[model samples]
Target chain A: MSTTISPKNAVQVEASAEVKAVHQQMLRQQRLNRAATYAVAILLVLWILVPIYLIASMAFTTPAAVRAYPKGVLPFIPFSFETMNFFLQSEGIIPGVINSIIVAIITLVLSTLIAAPAGYATSRFLFPGRDFYRLSVLAVRAFPIVVLSIPLAVVFINLGMYDSVYSLALMHTALALPTTILVIGSVFASIPFELEEAAQVFGCTPFEAFRHVVLPLVLPGIAAAAVFTFVMSWNEVFAASILTVQNRTLPAQVLAVLGQSSEPYQFAGAFFMMIPALIFIFFIRRYLFNMWGQVSK
Target chain B: MNEEKQSTQKKRKKINWAPYWLILPSLIYLALFFIWPMFRGLGLAVYNDEAALSLQTEPSRDAATAGTLPQGTQVEILDQQGNLIPPDEAGQANVITEVWYQISAEDADGNTVEGWVSESRIRVREENEAGAPTAGSVRTRIGAGDTLTEVYSEPNENAEVAGQLEARAEVAITDQSILEIWYQVRGEDRNQTVEGWAQSRYIQVFGETNTGRIDRGNTGQFTTEYLSKMVNDRFFWPATITTFLLMILIIPVQFVLAIVMALVIQARLKGNSLFLYVFTIPLGISELAVGILWFSIFTQSGFLNSFLQTTGLINTPITFLSADTRYWIIIAIWLAEVWRATSIVMVIVVSGLQAISDEVLEAAELFGASLWQRVRHVILPMLKPSLQVALILRTILALQVFAVVIALSGGDVVTVLANETYRQYSEFRNANVAAAYAGLILLISMGSAVIYLRMIRSQEEMAA
Candidate 1:
């Protein structure tokens, strides 16, 4: 323990040296781990981004060069505007976009309209049959979605709303409703009843209190649920294809003609569908845990 | 006191009606669209129809003139007429042959009658409308081969059978030649989709007229035969096994990758949030797009082949989609699904990692634990719920895999349950079979979920 340089202190010096060696070894181990981490991180990042870049590359690659991408990792092949231009000019793109937008918006609206009140009920009320209702909502998922589409096609045709956007919206609502109710229920439950009570006590009606005090607080939950519902509706294809003939959502149309389309058109259509979804997810990255994580728990 | 108690009890009797009012619309919507359709899909299964694939018109006999039923016909399949054709005879026919289903349907006379149909006779009723109406299909290799056929380029016998049309080869008769003496027949020559001319006399021609060719009395499609057809399809089992294998293969890879990823990102390294963002961007992409993205890379002239060729790894562009290249096709599908879906695992695992309290790890480290030990013991144990959820969810998603297989292989070399479901309901026009597939997939998903629930318990909760 002594710092004095004496012959008797040689053992102390060796012990200190040994301690330094161990510390250095630990540092070296840490450095190796850090390097491994970075290597893996970079590798994973590439794994995620390369395909996206390839899809984007297809978007810009000319028809002649469309299938001409350099192998393994793509070499910087010259970009081509032909495929995207053809897809954009082909009369189907704008209508598909519009139809998809209409469907998603309607789905969002219906899901929220139905979800908000039920979520509020689940949060605020200990009413009769509440557990049964929630359980049944969960049970709706017992049927895989594609199973419903063919039969729903019959039901919708019988209803004479078979090919309409509203018909698709209704089906999408059915798909999205359970999640919406469950999530919004969680959201509303998280918000204290005291604020709404305060608002009511201050002479506001229940609806008005909800509009002012609760909704503002409920916005984040609504936003999370709405983003999920939007993505779900936008990404859905099986039912969309089954329900529509002349009018199909973008994914549905792309799937219907996927095999027959030229390489460029297929890539372009695929990339085009990706834009909204990517953007939506980007907007909701913070809520990734909220949307999927809590649902599982 | 009694009056006050009665008043309180009376107030309790006025139940809250708002909850019922709130869920009513959604419940009705689910009832109409979800539940009802599901039941109808079940009804489609085992439905009886005169126009079902392989259904026969006569109960049993050698010369009963069995007519085939259209596939996906939902009528009362009331009874199975015993062995309309002998099983051995059906086997000889090279299709599923077993007991014929008795279908009740309206006859051309609009009377309710029971007729029998065999399975193989009713393929998708081929349309009589050909692009070239003047052309026809030639029956090849019939008994005792009427006349030795000669294919000529000019549809003239003098031109000769320079081209050989092998027995059992399906060749379509080309347009009627001059004076109709020589009819041009086009079919596959050794290696190509080829066209050549043959004397019409040598081959029997069915004109593209409304009176189409005959439906051969193929074997009956019993349930066993039907399942066998589905199983025997080249793509069916592979697609199914790949779907399963992908589910199995990707999980460990994903779990390891996800854990490592979660650890790296959680390390608070420089710009780690950026790393997370880049990783999760794919979470937004649809299954179909991810497929197309990889597809653009795996096609014959796609990125992978191009790279292989450019680098002088190979002289010719490999047909990655060929049926002969089943393993490569599966690899391409696996690559797409893994690249696309691992991010989901990463997201879930990262959250689970974040949930691991710092103190637990600090304590483990104090006990001289290494990073590997800590992960093996602490982190993985804590991640069970997430792992369970992820496994159950991803495996189910894998079972439901549809567009990805289609996008990668264009369903040329692989077929999964989702593909079958769609094909059954839409292309095959059989809602019942599709429903059966749907039900099967559901059963598998539920089974996995139950397994996950049983296997993976949250250790943190237990510790608490």
Candidate 2:
């Protein structure tokens, strides 16, 4: 299948080879940059891992060993469930943990219910005072928790609902509500309005259109909001402390014991308080950037 | 007919109020719990004191009188016209008939002005009425220990005496201005130095006076009540105010720091991702844990002091957690907050950076734009949306900061809104007040979110 070629085509092939050589050199430099980036990434990952390791190690160790001078980098003895048991049986830890879970769950549900529809309306509608509503939410977001907690304590007392888990959950929902709305709003905005219109054209009511077209698309963002809300409620202490006594949440319980606890219990309590949040963060890692970015924007 | 048809078309586009109904639950929660309670809390702070005073008007002017003022004695005004008189002259108000005084008279060296005139000290004195016969001479004498006696006679016969008169009464000088004589004196003398202590008809050859309004035996009960009142009064209000103020200060600072860190990391500097991960490591730590960690470093014999001493930066170890230096602990916590929370901003910013198309940057580069120009024109415009979101999120979280301060200072040096709320609900068992605090926080959080959304909306419009 040998055939004669034109001189013009032959010259063009030589020029293409030269261009390819330059591109290969640039690719080599890019590869070197990527290697350096990867090395740093590994070190950064270790920095986060080490402290967590230390906390876990301390939580598992006996009090005597924890107080031992020149504390070992690793647990000297075999891991014990004693520390965990101690935490579970401590003054208010178990009840607090349970209350924290209940409050967080309630907050997640209530905030999601309240925020999703508002978020959709915010993104889709051009209603009067829409801008005003947006600004109001932002202002609320900026208000200090302390300032509100004290006054709210008084209000709760007047309402005959002091020191209840319900109060804490309500307050936590308020804390999470604005972010929830913003997150879901952005998610709703990203889905084209045309999709809803199409659903309506296919014999769906406005509510049905949203249910079929918009809900499914924004479900990921809503899930992310729910997860973040749960984490926030779980981690919160101020409102929990202000709103509860015997019915304390985990973080509030940890805070109450902060000054009085033995070193081992203190470390254990801290560890226990953080586990849920850490696990939540890990589970939501994929959506962390997307969800937060949308909510913030 | 065409115009009418167009008007009908516009009317068809009107929105139903269904969305407003959807938001009603949150609105009701906000109004009942947040908005209304805030006004109520403010009312409590301002109006609660009036309820404690007696409501009688002109019942007896004797009740309004202050204690004896020594001849030519300078008395510093404690409170005037219901306002606290400052140490400086700026606080002096016009003298009023219905005044309560807490006068402190000190010598040049600032010691209490006290002196011994005689064993039964005698000083000639005139009563408030100039023409009336002298209420004799008041004889002051030191008995045993911290006891004194004042003897005086009411020589005026024409004085309207409605109360019983007693002689040889025991009296004590309770405070600088108070002479609590146990006998009744004639007429109401609101201007007399020894007012509100006893009736003016009280006179004695030598008597000890008790001028205090409260009985010493029942002091423990009074103190407990007073403490509870103070907690309800000065402590709660100031604490709440301080918490809100600190939050306002911290939230913006934290937000700016976080945003700055995010922007710096996203600028694609050397080891950017590594720095980001390092920044984020602190976020894994609980606020209390972080507070404790920093406290260990900042306490009197902690790492900071040791470092300073070893470096010869100071002669002695500093007390970072002492009453004097606890402010530094607050600063340290702020630093810890930056370390822990900045990672959040970095993460948010990085995501935003990724969202921007590379083509825009490449186009800018093709135009031979400088780094600053590209950042100013290309990068920032794209990042505004993320910045708005970051601001709202950080502000809301920062406003609620509590555990860190409590863990670090144990409510000694710092108190925030959350701490006050905690104290009210947990320690004081005042749920109504705690709910009020929660209500304020809700308002603040919602308000900030609204602001952030509006800003982003405007920016979007501007960009368009």
Candidate 3:
């Protein structure tokens, strides 16, 4: 085709040159699109980093330095852990942190335990009321914990279980359960049923097949669900506040004492509360897309 | 063949109920915790009244003969049964009783009069002197201005001009003050009857004229002052409402920002992988930490004003924590929330985004489409299913927003649904109204879910 075009008359060769120019213009536009993408990337990074920088600086500053008006951009004085120590020594901080960890763990375990098999059932079984079950889970997911927590508080009081960590865990489980079910259901659905059927052919029971074949295949998805549930439970405050008073969670304790203290103590408390979540998020960053995709769909 | 068919039918009857068993715990938990409490709370809001528990009443015959209650009465105590004993008097027989009863009466025009009726005036029905029915009736003394205040009246020209003519006219005079008489005359030439201070010399007394008298005490005016007093008495109750308003202000803003971030990330732009990681970092940060972070920047002597001053943007450092600057603190918290929560949305959206087949995009690209055209026509439509889920989840979470706001604002400028519930359970020690607010939140969440379902259905139809 190139040889044929080369031997063409002068007027026809001019037409081919015009086509080449159009192709060059398309190339230029593609290059411009790439530049625009980079610009967006840069802007997004800056948008995310600025607040983080502010928080880090505040967490590190000394009490006097933090209180000083017109604080220098950099920590002008040497950073100290005095604020953090103050928070650690404050009333309810240690217990609150411990309670938060315990509640989150229990919530993670219970939600995963209940939601996994149910999620699997939802994905695999062609049962009656399947759609209803899915819709009901969605409805539960939509029910505000604030509204639910108030009534739950009363009920707990009546049952003589108010202000207990167990109640907090229960409420947290309720909050995280819907997402767990949905994510695991989607994860299970993505894995072929044929694998389970093949296990059945090897003389395994239905339960055994699921335990070996389906569970192993969906482990990544389950881990993602666990992480999501943990973060949710960790971050939760309203229900925790309403549910527990003496045994407050970390967020609740911090919140209860917010703005009541010196700037350094407040910053230190905030910084400490955020650390676990940040570390957890970093480790599980890759699964975020998968987890979100499953939940959203 | 018949046996084989029968055995197959028998085997089919043994269906697995394990799924039902699996969901049983959650179902039981919901039924006991959510559904039951909801109905109970609703009952309290609609039916129960703490004030009504103290009210007591006794049976009576004629409305007028029932008691000696006068108009415009104010007393601290109602009828005390113990105070009804007769005093020693009247020819060695106890005739005077000391019963104290709160009596309220209203005239035909609906103006209420209320006062304490003495036990002596309240005569119990007894057999007549000759076995006929008999009951005691008290004649109330008219005071100054005690007559019906003339709301409206018609004038009689002949009566005003000293003509001795009978005219159908309405006259109202109170026992307290007959000096000010209100008269409405109905005649051929009727006009408004004016109210004036009548001279005592012009008055004529008649025995039967007061026969239709209404036994009433002075009814207090329902003034703005009284209403305000009532509200003050129940000030703790309204705190729930304030808390709800605060929650509404903070939660939805965070939710919107979060959803937007999620959607943008899910758009599958280049370098979103790194962005997703960055966004998730705030999830690890505690609400207190997020608050402190923003506080560091905005406090009077913090980073923000310092930066501005160093850059010569301001003449002096500004105080950000003052009462006046607290509103800006709320905005800073909002930014913190956006930073913290957008990752959640991003995660949800990205997952949803991935579920969309690449083939769909390929098909659109093959059809000679621009990137915008592909996103508008191909991606968004496919994203609807996920968007609905995201919206429902985000809204529920948003309604319960507390920690971030509390941490950031130190519970000063920010109040929310969750915060109000906390205040009720903690500060005021009133669980009932707090539960009521919680119930309101539940209603909102359920309503949103219903709307979401309707939206998703319509979107589905549109897609189809």
Best by DockQ: 1
Count: clashes, candidate 2: 78
Model 2, docking class: acceptable
Residue range B289-370, candidate 1, lDDT tens digits: 8788888888888877777778789888878877788777678877877777777888888777777898998899778898
The best candidate in terms of lDDT: 1
| Candidate 2 structure quality by residue, lDDT tens digits, B1-464 | 99999999999887668667766666676665556656655444433321211211222333543333222222222111122223343223322111112212232333442221111233223333443222222243345452323221221222232222112222222211112113232222245333222222222222333221211110011113323554565556655665566556566676555555555555476666446545555554567766655554565554556557767788876667655775675687676566567667667777888888879888996686865688789877788777666777677777666677776677756676666656666777654455455555656777877887887788778979
Tell me each candidate's TM-score. Answer: 0.71, 0.62, 0.69
As a whole number from 0 to 100, the lDDT of residue A259 in candidate 1 is: 80
DockQ of each two-chain model: 0.38, 0.25, 0.36
Which residue runs does candidate 3 get wrong by more than 4 Å?
A: A1-16, A75-77, B1-13, B47-272, B283-288, B321-330, B362-371, B408-414, B452-464
lDDT of 3 at B250: 51
Q: Write the per-residue lDDT of candidate 1 for residues A229-258, one digit (tens) a residue.
A: 888788887788778888988888888888
Question: How accurate locally is residue A133 in candidate 1, as Cα lDDT from 0 to 100?
Answer: 81
Question: Candidate 2: misplaced stretches above 4 Å?
Answer: A1-29, A75-78, B2-15, B49-286, B292-335, B364-385, B388-400, B413-464
List interface RMSDs for the candidates, in order. Answer: 2.5, 5.0, 2.7
- Tens-digit lDDT track of model 3 for A1-297: 877667577668898899789779878986887677666656666777776766556667577766776666666255777666777888898898899999999999998988887887888887778888887776666666666776677778868899999888988887788778888888888899999999999999988998988888889878977987898788777678778878999888877666567677777776676776767787778766665665554
Model 2, position B91: C-alpha lDDT score: 28
Residue B304 in candidate 3 has what lDDT? 81
Worst 10 residues of 2 chain B by lDDT: B214-223
